[model samples]
Target: MSTPELHWFKSSYSSSNEPGDCVEVAVASAAVHIRDSKTPHSARLAVAPSAWVNFLAVVGERR
Candidate 1:
């Protein structure tokens, strides 16, 4: 499938000087897009809105 059109945003914790380890995310329709910042053209994983919220909550608890 073709990649969806999206406006990507990097994590606030990402550093301007170091882009290698950063990830980019975008929201399209009811799905969320996730991809490596260094490879924008590469395949991205899409997650449902609810799943994305749960993932974030779990991640926040781990911090």
Candidate 2:
């Protein structure tokens, strides 16, 4: 399947001066897109909404 067009967004923790460490995300029709902000043109990972929520929950617990 072809990748869907996405409008990516970065977390508030992202910094313009340290773009390399930033993680960008986008919501598409069937999945969520995740890619490095420093290399947006590179390959991205897609995750289902349920998986994304679980991942975020884990991340939140670590924070």
Candidate 3:
């Protein structure tokens, strides 16, 4: 099996300036992928859609 290409987008909170630490995310049918915007080729983290939703909910409550 092969991995399909993902369309990643930068986090809205990331700095608008270039050469800064940033986070990127890509949503797939099975998982949400997260990675550093600067080192895109580096290892990434993937979580189930449900887990991602739960995470957002938890984080939202703290805001």
Candidate 4:
């Protein structure tokens, strides 16, 4: 199956004027897409929405 077109955006936490190490994400109905902002065309990761939520929760807890 062909990949759907995704509108990716950088995390709001990334406030640097110059591009640094950051990740981009695109939300889809079935999954969340994640990729290195510096390398958009490189390999990406796709995770279920629930998994994404859990991952974010874990990260937030560490903050």
TM-score of 1: 0.78
Which digits, one per residue and each the tens of the lDDT, describe model 1 over residues 19-48?
A: 687888898887988988888899999899
- Tens digit of lDDT per residue, candidate 4, span 1-63? 997899999975464685867889999999999998988999999999999999899888877
Judged by whole-model lDDT over C-alpha atoms, candidate 4 comes out at 0.87
Hey, what RMSD does candidate 4 come out at? 2.0
Q: Is candidate 2 or candidate 3 better by TM-score?
A: 2
Please list the residue runs of candidate 2 whose C-alpha ends up more than 4 Å from where it truly belongs after superposition. 1-4, 13-17
Q: Which stretches of candidate 3 lie above 4 Å from their native place?
A: 13-19
Write the residue-wise lDDT of candidate 2 on 1-63 in tens digits: 876568989965466678578999998778988988879999989899899889888877877
Error of 1 at 39 (Å): 0.9
Q: What residue pairs are clashing in model 2?
A: none
lDDT of 3 at 42: 95
lDDT of 2: 0.84
**All predictions: root-mean-square deviation over Cα?**
2.9, 2.6, 2.2, 2.0
- Work out the TM-score per prediction: 0.78, 0.79, 0.78, 0.83
CA-lDDT, candidates in order: 0.85, 0.84, 0.88, 0.87
Model 4 alpha-carbon drift over 4 Å, by segment: 1-3, 13-18
